[model samples]
Each structure stands twice: as structure tokens, then as C-alpha cells.
Target: MAWHKKPKTNLTKLRIVRMIVQIIMFFLLNLVFFEIGANWLVLPINMPQTIFSSSEGSFFLLQRMLSRAIIPLIPLASFLIIGGIFGRLFCAWGCPFGLFQDIIGLITSWVKKYEPTHSTNNSMRQIGELITGGTLLISTFIGISVGLGNQADVEAAFGSFFEQPWAVLSPAVFLFTAIPVIVYWGVLGELFRIENLGSIDILLWIRLAIFIGAIIMIIYIPRGWCRWICPVGIIMGRLGEHSLIGVGRNITKCNHCGICEDVCPMGVQILSHPAERVRSVHCTNCLDCIPACDEDAMELKIL
Candidate 1:
């Protein structure tokens, strides 16, 4: 007796669900402001500020020292614990910046009639790794030495820098601060009859350049910033090595089609390895692979 082949799963449906969830989360975090009972249960995680906060906390602790100042632990700890359990799902499913990139990427793909290739160049990936690793190392060293040291003059010189270095130019800053300011000054100012909107500075130009560059890169390379330069994603990726949850494969069912690898925006070699689960630091737990697999071989598992 001949057996019939099982129908392929329509992963597009799952992707739609994820997209809706991402949209709701983005708006909720950016728009909603409320409290629960006596506790402020939900609050927008300021993406740029949180990146600096996490780095500072990790640096001080790693140096076998404690910060005299009260460093906010919620964002740092949340990234660690959540990443350790679910990998970089937050980057895939929650980051406003990530959402923005994905939207643009989809549009680019539609217009170009093809999906942009994920950066698979070994040298490029290495450069990305170095950038993220170097940022952490250098930041930690400076933070521990100059910011925390007893040299008052030195500390004062680097104090503000430590507070937020590249953060002012982050995409989050552009989306949250720059856009709003531009609208208020450029558009609303005319209606309000407020002539003194403020002068553009060098820093503003730098930020605009960065923002525009990021957009162009995202259009050409899927998840360009997260894959190549996001220090926050790099940190979460390191923690994800020991994540309790990951996408696993049923080896027997896999046809070795390489579709999963193709769909992966991070260019993970999902089929090249014999490991039962995808542990690639780049895996965002986006589950794009699940839908890409026509053989029904992949599933998320607790491991």
C-alpha cells in the first residue's frame, strides 16, 4: 500500500500572527502609559537607554566591583533571563527598530521581486563579531577605569560620555526623539506661530546620516544592524548560547532541502550541522524556518 505525503505547513499564517503581535507590542510600548494597582507593572523599555544601562551593569559586575549609583537592573536582567530562555526572540518579535527594518525589508523585497540575501560572508560576520565584542570590551574598560576611578578630572571628562555614547545616534533615538522634534518644529510650528523652532546642529546632522544609512542598509541586507552592529543583540546572542528554549529538528523527517537555511535572515547554517537544535548565536527564534520547512521537520522545543 502506498502512503500519501503530508501537506506542507503554511508558515505564512504564523508569520502574519507574529507580525500582528509585533505591531501591538510596538504601539503598546510606545503609546500606552498606565499602572497596575500600586505597581507600575508595564512601562516602555527605552531601547537606547536600556542598551547603555545593560552594558554598564555587566561591566561593573564583571570587574568584581559595585556601582555606587543605583543602576537600573530591570532591563538588564530582563534581557539576560529572557534571552537565556527564548534566545533573541525579543529582537525578532518585540524591538521597534527591528519591526521598522522588517517592514522596510518586506517592501524592498516586493519592489525588487526577490528577497535580499542575508550576509553570509565569513569576513563580514567576523567584522560584526569584532565590532560588538570590541564595543563591549572598550566600553567596559573605560567605564571601570575612568568613570569609576578616583581621578575627579578624568571622571568628569568621561562622565557624560559614559551615560550614553552612541545612543544619541541610535535608530531608537531618531524614531522616538528626532522625528517628533522635526514634526513639531517643521509642521506644528507653522500652525502654532512659533518661529523659534531651534537650530540644526552637527550632532543632528550626524544622527540623520546614521538613520538614513541604517535604512538603506536594511533595505539591501536583511536585519543589517542587528546582524552586523547591534551591541544589544550581540549581548543577547551570547547569553542565548545557553538558552533553555530553541528550535529543534526531527532529523528523520528532514529532507535536507536547505529551505530553512534560505529563509533564515541571519544566514545561519541550519542544515550544515548535525546538532538536534539550532544554537547559532545569530538565530533570533523568529521561526521563519518552521514555515520554510516543507517536510515538517522543525519545531520549537525546551532543551
Candidate 2:
């Protein structure tokens, strides 16, 4: 009798697919943001409890669900739980910031030989987490304070909070849209013929600088922005825990080759230890590991 052996996993194909999807979404978001802001086809909206301040944001889904009070919190709760389980897949496959990093990575590659290195420092990342915590706490306070006696008061208070507090600290606006406009026009545009342009709002500049600085940090490491400075990422990371959806690693049949870790844009240690547990909150669930692994040791599982 002949012994049978399984084939090794190949990741190039999978990474290509993810890269393609991210690219498509990035372009689409750019168009959507432009249409809403420049063409006025879609009206601007706000999230009553925006995790952070961003002019272009809304909690439409959350607001509707919570307002009715009929549908159990299970739905929203399920979403967070499932998302966390699968790693922060949304950030890798869906977030505009992730897409931006991909684009910038391309630019940096062409301009010079930039190695994909890890941003080892965790202090800046901690600060981002603190800011996100503060935002959530304050938003909750505003929600409770305004609705102290009546639903009408709660609605009014939430509305006021979103308009003022949330719009200002939204790192997404600066990271995804504002600073890109600035540097693309200010530095990269002048040097290259790219259609890069940016705007300056004195009031928004300070927060904008923080986001821009995050991107600059990316120069040292891939996904430095998402890893260290994004509040949106912070929100998603928290929600990811207890998520019904997740990936599992088959460690018994495994070799400890580090291919999966190498491909991880978010800098997670995928191949180390028992495969089932990936502790880094930054895992984007991009599945870059599945294809990269030669042993076919990884699979996605739902709890």
C-alpha cells in the first residue's frame, strides 16, 4: 500500500484576490464620499453614538435597531461577536484605511525599496485605545445624561453630541480622507502627476495631524496606522471578541513555519503556538495565512 500525502497551501492566489477586493472597495468609497460631499446626492448624516468624531459618519443601523427596542440587542451583539471571531476581517477586506495602506504600500514600493517591517512599539497603539475608550465613555454619558428624564431629551442630547463631540475626533475623516488630500496635493502631487489634493480646516487640523502622523509611521511598518492610531480599529477589535465567526488552526498536523506571520499585514503571530488562538486584536481575518501555509493547517470556524 502507498502512503498518501496532502498538498501544501499556496497563498499567492488568495492574497491577490484580497488585494483585488480591497482595491475595488477603495475606489468605490472614494467615489461615494466625493458624490455625497461634492455633488450633494446623498445628505450627510451622523451617528448618535459615533465611536469617534468624523464629519462623514452615521449610526443609522444602530440608531434604528436601538430605537425600536423590539429587535433584541442580539443582532448588533451577534455582529460584533462574529466579526471578532473571524479576526478583524472587516479592516483588511472592508476598511478604507486598510485599502489606503495598500495603495501607499504600492507607492512606496515604486519610489524605493521598502521592506514590510513590523512597528514594534505599542505605546502609540495604547494611546489610540485610550482615546477610543474615552470616546465610548463620553458618548454613553451624553446619551444617559440627555435622556435622563425622557426619551425626547435623550434624542436631543444624542443628536447634539454627535454633531459636536463625535464629528471632531473621527480619525477616519482625517486618516481616510482629509490628510490624504493634504499630502497628495502638498507633497506627492507636486512630485508626481497624481490627482492628489487636500483641504485645511484650522479647527480640524490638530486631530488631522494625529491621523497623518499615524500614516507617516506606516513608512516604518505596514499597517502602522491601523495598528497604532485608529479608533475605528479599536471599536472593531473590542467587538471582535466573542464573535460567533472565527478561524481555527490545526496545530497537531502543523509545522511551525512562519509564512502566515509574514503575510499578515496587521502584524499578527499566526503560526506560533497552538493555531486556534490568535491573540493580536489587529488580525484582519484577511486569510492571508490560509494560502500562505503549506500544511493546510488553518481553517475558519464559527462559535
lDDT of 2: 0.54
lDDT of each: 0.62, 0.54
Q: What TM-score does prediction 2 earn?
A: 0.64
10 residues in a row with least lDDT, candidate 1: 36-45
What local lDDT score does residue 138 receive in model 1, on the 0 to 100 scale? 45
Clashes of 1: 0
Candidate RMSDs in order: 6.2, 8.7
Clashing pairs in 1: none
Q: What tens digits encode model 1's per-residue C-alpha lDDT throughout 1-303?
A: 111122135666777777898888665554322321221222222253221122222322322221222343654666677777887887788776788888988788745422433345344556557755654454555555554554465447655344444455567667765676668568545533545435545676677788899888888778877776666667677777678988878998998877777767777788765558888777888888886787889888788
List model 2 lDDT by residue over 86-137, tens digit each.
5466677756657767677756754432343345435557876886566555
Clashes (N, CA, C under 3 Å) per candidate: 0, 13
Candidate 2 positional error at 117, Å: 10
